[model samples]
Target: AHGVARPAAPLSTFLVGFAAARNGGTAADIEQACATATGLALEWAKTHPTETR
Candidate 1:
């Protein structure tokens, strides 16, 4: 999502919400998912930033 259009932000949020709805959609689960995603994104950015979407 690094160089994508602004619309992608809401799309990503929707996807995450959809995924949460499929699961428990609880606060703890959401926090865990966000933390995991943040860690992975940070790692990817460090190693392969230019490959970002």
Candidate 2:
């Protein structure tokens, strides 16, 4: 979300936690959620790239 919006960082983290909690809040759940979020973010960054300024 670098080229997107400043609020996306916190919002994305909140969403990852929310997803983990909804799935049971176990270690595995948290890991899965983080991995999923990170993977998506990476893919998005690939297409979006970082902001110039």
Off by over 4 Å in 1: 1-8, 50-53
- Full-model lDDT for every candidate: 0.68, 0.88
- How well is each residue in 1-53 modelled by candidate 2, as lDDT tens digits? 55557788899889999999999999999999999998987888789767675
lDDT of 2: 0.88
Candidate 1 global CA lDDT score? 0.68
In candidate 1 the C-alpha lDDT for residue 6 amounts to 64
Error of 2 at 24 (Å): 0.7
Sequence-dependent TM-score of model 1: 0.57
lDDT of 1 at 11: 70
Candidates in order, TM-scores: namely: 0.57, 0.79
Clash count, predicted structure 1? 0
